[model samples]
Target chain A: MTTMDHLAEQTKLERLLQVDEGSLGFVAEQEVQATRAFRQQLSEFYYQRHQDAFHRLAGLSKLLPISASAKLAMNLLGPVLAAGIACELPKDRAAKLAGRLPTDFLAKLSLYLEPSRAGAIIAAVDEDHIVEVARHLIAQQEFITLASFVTVISESTLRRIIQQVGNDGLSLLKVGFYVEEKTALNNVVTLLSEQQRRALFLAADEHSLWPAVLSLLPYLNDTLQGEMSNLAAEGEEQARDKLVRAVAQQGDWYPLLLSWTRMSQENLESSIRLPALHEEALLRECMAQLEKHNLQQALPNFTELLTEEQQALLA
Target chain B: MSSPIETLRQEGLPEQALAYLTALPEEQQQTLAQQVLSTMQKKDERVEKALSRALDVVPAPLRRTVRKMLFS
Candidate 1:
């Protein structure tokens, strides 16, 4: 058989291995051996029609376990497959190729090539496709790893793509549930515009929002703080304290104190905490300044530096 | 003769006197033994206060173990 014919035969055997069930253990061992042979064949197949070779390789990937298939596809195709896909691969063929590959394999492949190819994949991937793929991966409890891969895409473009997907995009976020989603969303929020960030904050459940806001606090700028303060204004006292604590922890204690000062005297006394001595003397200095200034005039811009424990003490 | 504890305590030994104490000679170690005693005493007292405060905040189920470790 010619080299091309031999490779085609090997690809046929791999496809059979995927569904064959005589003995899983024997098939798994044979598949590994076949994979090594396929790698050698792939090296020679490099000069042939790239699309034909990729179609065969995608077939081979399906025969292996998802993890093994993903690794093999990455090793064999890597940048080359991505480049080929980026160039005028017909849309039907591109979709077919994407459909055949495992979600993890597709995600990894997206990372290998030029940024433009990655962008193309992100743009080409419809919201349903993303949600479907994300849901499948989440069902397998691998969303954390998947989120790490998604973060590899350039942040601005990622934000745009996700925004285009809208509430449907939230399905991907929801797949991982609150804590996991909060970690990932914290990353996504940092990459988003102020408006986009606010939208996400407003969309999240109340319990989820507190932790998400706390995680984002250290990284938030003045604009985000203003948005957060507005959001907190509608929440209950405990929720407001959570926001204040986050602001204080982020080194915006002056603004936090100012916000508290503007509350009715009873509320202010009930909610805000003073700094203890051992917990950074700077906190005490801010407290003294707050005391010195008229409650209405000098409070807004002053920031404090209290540790959480100290703040708890004062509270 | 100044008792070592008295001397160290007078010098604000626990916070500001760590450096000076470490510089003393081996033979002088016995002379400053009481300073070590006073330091331990103060540490024990502070630890007790911290434990009591922690107990007030921590839920009841966790307080017993936390108190044992704190006192010990």
Candidate 2:
């Protein structure tokens, strides 16, 4: 590796070490193995280019947090840590940590640790601290229990948390929020709760909201379907024409079309008609695209919406 | 008698296959099984031709073993 690469790796390792004890323990174990693999690769490269390797390592030591002596110490001790201490320390500490942690933190932390009990402790930490730790753990991809964290934290609270974390924080928050929102939306739809469905619909304007809506489609009730259909019709002519255009540009209109079809089927006369005065070509193009994508499975109630001719066209 | 692979495939096992593949170590076992199954299907005509050609040189007992190994 070049000096810059070595420096970068060391910085990452330092950052990993600086994390909370629970996170540090997890990362140290992962890094010890990764470093061994990296060292072997570096050694092979060094053998082929001795001068290059020496220069890189020399420069890298200068740039890295560790002094040359420390690097040497790590080179010697890292294996012992990774193999013996890393494995052994966490097993006991993790249990102690879990017993001390709160229920919410324990839940989130469980997603990252190997033995479920250990994870429970890491997750059980204080909520604010857990959020910070979770942010760090997520950056390292160490914590796998993100879905659990979503249940305890509301979407609005998650959004505020992301705002505080800044842009990079927002990106991670978005991923976690998307997963959580989708699960919550699906849960609401399965329960067919009117209030929950309306809440999800209001939240739908955000890009992060689509996954939740997509997930809920299969379980959507007639009331929810009709609400979405009305939104689509109203949205098409609203001042926020840009939003409608964006949805249209997404190419695969299966979800919207399927929802609309279901709503129309449920309340055939009351539902919005395909405006006869509108462009027939646009509607035809969408129908053709749906057929091309073979998305008929999403529109199982198409027979109720279309006439024999249109039904045949779909077939 | 159903083999493990056959039983798995018959049980609408794609979901299970995906879950197994996700959880498995990045070793050759999972991928190799998939590759072998796909190749067996795609090269069925060539396999039949090769088997017909082999019957002339090999005894029926040896042929059965080869057939079972390749097809299974």
Candidate 3:
């Protein structure tokens, strides 16, 4: 699995257990599906153990008027229990209650809400409310909660949220790294304007987020991957050097090289021209990866771009 | 006395979850196992505690009614 896959699984596990990130890093090598399955089991176990109480709260919501139920949840049950009760309530009713609750409270509740279990409830909520809660979560740095909900929201709602998120590429990068659905992330990328797309590369440079940027490249379609790689090459030489060094440090040139195949010839040449790429050790390692993955054919354009000395080293 | 790994197995943690934990250094395993157990054990405790706090906020006469609404 890629580093992002491991991080994604680790993030999900951490969120499931309400633990800090890195607390579960030991499990980074476990199969992603195993982490997912284990999280599911834990969720099911907790829900089963507390179903009666949560069901009771759901029952009470049905017994009371909608506004009163919302008050009871906010004033009494708190976000965690309220979220549990909301999961058990009818999706429409939960949506109505969500409307009555404050966006801040809803944002708090979202941290505990299981997207898979409450997908319909989340979908039933108004787009405006979802946007409001998303803003609140973003302000609070609740990217994990935001990322978890990404899979459940309508694409249109997501587009609106991304629009509101504007040019904060770093926030999107952090959330994207933890996103479980790469295709959803890819779709989100498709929605970006050229400026927004460029901001992502700039953010990667400014924030040393090349690993995240590199990990994300493999998920984009050929056109977007090429476009993104071209954009990445437009960064300063120092930034490009940082990216190449990051790849070398990661010891995983697969994502970088694979993206090179899709890049415009000029952009690929620009990327390969980085002084960092000429490092003997790094070039040899890149060649080894190319041979290991049987992808030399993927880099025909790249071969023409290499210096004579670099080509000799790679050969 | 069972090992921390065994204790986790007995605590209803799934095999897949423990499999990763089992690979850690013994000291790390003990630490992580304790952490996992604490998180798992918090479910009931947190619910009961939250319910108690909720009940404490209700008017005396309404507390019983709310309790009935919740448990009934």
lDDT (10s digit) by residue, model 1, range B1-72 = 886645545544443233333444544444334434443455335333433443453357756764554344
DockQ of each: 0.01, 0.01, 0.48
Interface root mean square deviation for model 3, in Å?
Answer: 2.8
Every candidate's fraction of true contacts kept comes to 0.00, 0.00, 0.49
- How would the candidate models be sorted by DockQ, starting from the highest? 3, 2, 1
Quote the lDDT for B56 in model 3: 62
Query: Model 2 over residues A83-113: C-alpha lDDT tens digits?
Result: 1111223333433333444444433334323
Per-residue CA lDDT of candidate 3, range A111-132, in tens? 9888889999999999999999
Off by over 4 Å in 1: A1-96, A102-117, A137-212, A215-224, A242-315, B1-72
Error of 3 at B51 (Å): 3.3
Error of model 3, residue A28, in angstroms: 2.7
Query: Chain B alone: TM-score in each candidate?
Result: 0.40, 0.27, 0.63
lDDT: worst 10-residue window of model 2 chain A: A78-87
Predicted candidate 1 versus true structure: per-residue lDDT over A147-254, tens digit per residue: 534533445544554555354323333322222223444545445554544444454434343333433343345454445545445445555545544444444344
Q: What TM-score does structure 1 among the candidates reach?
A: 0.32
What are the clashing pairs of model 1? Answer: A254-A302, A254-A303
- Greater-lDDT candidate between 1 and 3: 3
- Those runs of model 2 whose alpha carbons end farther than 4 Å from true positions after fitting are A1-177, A180-185, A188-193, A206-212, A215-244, A264-277, A293-315, B1-72
